[model samples]
Target: MKLPVLYTFRRCPYAMRARISMYYSKISYEHREILLKERPKKLYQLSPKGTVPVLNLPDGKVIDESLDIMKWSVSVNDPDSWYVNNIDHQLEIISINDKEFKKWLDRYKYHDRYPEYSVEYYRGKCEKILDNFEKILDSEKFLFSNNISLSDIALLPFVRQFSNVDIIWFRNRFINLSGWMDELIGMDIFQAMMKKFEIWNPFGKGEEVIFNN
Candidate 1:
């Protein structure tokens, strides 16, 4: 039998984290591209919450959250620094990303909704997270360690998106982060994961392909 499948939305930071884990762990699995506005029946059946980044395990287990999916994939083929074996500072970064950064990112990305404030004001709020991350990057090669850790992968996608709203301005303002983010995007893994697939009819497993080189 084939390995289980993962349903994901291409642009979602949450799904990007899960994909990064699977890619780094060298886990092979099928995939389904999902549209947030119109979720497929198959995915919704398994993921009652109707969120992307759902994992359907081979043993019939279903994982709905992105973090859960990430942990599961890493657990299966985890290398040296993954799992609880050698993890340090990964969890702390995750906490900051999920709790503090994610909160302001939502508002900053949709600045029009917060009409009371200028886009620059909200952008500054989001930039604070990037500034904090940039400081960490300035100190080391990765966010948590010299080597790329789960923390870096989990936060990179969101940071990538956070940087894109005003790419030229951001690049000029923070050249260090621009280079770092560019390096991440220049990778084959990120390029493959971010491709857009044409909308397809509702289908069963293996109908769609995952091109994670």
Candidate 2:
């Protein structure tokens, strides 16, 4: 069978979430690790936006958005019920993470790039979203319930990025959120999702890497 092709950058949170979802769903695919500086011509051809975590289906359909990739993976096979409950609410939380929280997170992570605000100001903006997550997590193990769901997988990478900006600060506050992060980060699927691969060569003899195999 011709597996789906995934173009990914290791440290990109968007790619990370896509990998996490694929790994969790046990959907095997062709892993094509790419460098942002030297992106393959085919990647741009496949996705005009030229973003990482682009999924090229065997049938020629392409999924460029990371969240869409996650949704697609779960749609194929959701053994753990990742997409089974509270879908509307889950999408709402994911929207906050993607649209609102991501803006503040980018500013916070690269505070030097955005000189209009202090680092603390950016962090403060991020904390408002984190505080909401903490409140939800305080009552349950995962975002929506004790069991992990689509929202948890969708939001984990971004929250992990936010925590890494200043881990000590993150650990000092948000006890529930920190524990939740730790649990997800330590999972076998997460660890597998993070394994590094050689950069893919679109023109040369680059061996195919099977993700979630």
Per-model TM-score, in order, reads 0.88, 0.95
Off by over 4 Å in 1: 80-88, 207-213
Tens-place lDDT per residue, model 2, 1-213, is 788889999999899999899888788788889999999999899988899989989899999999999999999888889899999999999999989999999999999999998999999999998899899887899988999998998888999899998899899988998999999999998998898889997875333546444
TM-score of 2: 0.95
lDDT of all predictions, in order shown?
A: 0.77, 0.90
Query: Which TM-score value belongs to model 1?
Result: 0.88
* C-alpha RMSD of candidate 2: 1.5
Itemize residue pairs with steric clashes in candidate 1.
none
Output the number of the lDDT-best candidate: 2
Each candidate: RMSD to true structure? 2.6, 1.5
| Candidate 1 local lDDT, 63-102, one digit each (tens) | 9888788788777777747555335467777888888888
